[model samples]
Target: MAHPQPRTETSSDAALIRAWQAGDEQAAAELVARHARPLARFLAGAGAPDADVDDLVQETFIRAFRGVDRFRGHCQFRTWLLTIGGNVLKDFGRRAARRKVMPLDESVRDVTGDPHEHAEASEVEALLAAGLKQLPRLQREVFLLRAQQGLEYAEIAAALATTPGAARVHYHHAVRRLKEIVE
Candidate 1:
């Protein structure tokens, strides 16, 4: 018996979008699988709570699917998805502000270690989360996109609707501030 050949990943997001629009449910799944974890990490690093990350991710995908027809290939799909995730974060922040609730803690992970190491890591994570909260909105977005999501300045700028230079500045300032706090 002959073995079936494995499918290759699509070279471009436009192809995936076309597949999705053509009613291939697997295409949507592929897109989500490609982008979801990074988006969740971006949200968590931007001060969203661990409990709310999954809901926010679901909402992001729903919004993306609803508006996929509007997506032109001007930017990469990751950039576009980050833009959607940013908007969701902003909306949540606005609502939280209106309700007079504190924004969620930005730290969600506890890296495994010995007891002393665990304690030290926890303290550092808490401090880092506090420092992240102190950053301006744009700085936080830029920093998280670059640091957590590993997006380049161009991608960060596209996601945040800013110039690459501006994104670089925001990221620099964020790194400086975080270093001051962490070190």
Candidate 2:
């Protein structure tokens, strides 16, 4: 490999991956450090609870590093990482679904403060959460990727393994439903 360029926030992920492949551990750390925030945001927006987002982010990177050989240059690295994260959360949801539901006060409550106790923005956020939960999984994921993460439809399509046209349709449906619910 050519002289490794200085690692910075702006360094291309492909370059970081190449250095990592060449045995530079720091390159891997830089990759995680650079993208972890965005990955966490995506996870949170995709319906991961506050308590679980950190673990999900770590697992996403672990899977990515272990499966690096399989990563084709089909999408941006962050997009790929988000895809891994969505899978992790899906698996977690599946396991949780198998367990019996517990009453909110008995089984568990969100560690984040009371969902009901809040001002205007908080109320709006709560409403949005309820609306999001009602969306079909694909529509919810598409909406979050496009609206919250600011990804283009092509990137969202790549991450979600759908066509760009389908992704666009999902986004429109999600927006219509959320508007009906939130407003």
Candidate 3:
């Protein structure tokens, strides 16, 4: 008799995806656990109110699983996930706009060691957030994917469904505008 190998956390996302497709529910949960925080960060950077980030993240994963068959392996799974998340946020934004409810800027202020330093950092973050809101959708997405998530231009291109060159151009324009806004 042979013993079955235990599942390892080191499993690649592709393997997890395959297992999920095979109806292994644990695989889906694992994927969510692995990607949730990063996905939340991306959603929040894309202008999701802090309160809505969790719901948006859950919705993104739900949509991704529902449409898993449409995902080609052309990009990393995280990149694909982020793209779905962006769409989810956009849809939420539209609904929120229709309701005429303005989202509050409620980013948590770090109450840590140095009060003055924390205040300075929060001010910079606020300025950057304001600048991001002013950018066009594609430019904001490209900038957040690059500057916030550290995704390469090619991955960002795949996520945004644009050419890498176009992604780079958008990122450049975003950076230039942000400098003018934040500085």
**Candidate 2 wrongly placed segments (more than 4 Å):** 101-118
Mind giving the per-residue lDDT tens digits that candidate 2 earns over 1-183?
666478778778998998898899999999998999998988877777777788889999999998998888888998888888888988877776788542132114433555446344556776787788789988988888888889999988987778999999999999999999999
lDDT of 3 at 160: 73
In model 1, what is the error at residue 94, expressed in angstroms?
Answer: 2.9
lDDT string, candidate 3, 1-183, tens digits: 965345799998888888888798999999999999999998887889887888999999999998888888888999899989989999999999999989886446325767788778778988998899899989998998899889999988876778999999999999999999999
* Runs of candidate 3 exceeding 4 Å displacement: 1-6, 107-115
Query: Model 1, range 67-140, lDDT digits (tens) per residue?
Result: 99988766788778877888898898889889898744434444455867777777887788789989998898
Q: Candidates' lDDT values, in order? A: 0.81, 0.83, 0.88
Residue 11 of model 1, lDDT score: 39
Query: After best superposition, candidate 2 residue 28: deviation in angstroms?
Result: 1.4
Per-model root-mean-square deviation over C-alphas:
4.4, 3.4, 2.4
Candidate 1 weakest ten by summed lDDT: 103-112
Clashing pairs in 3: none
- lDDT, model 3, position 181: 99
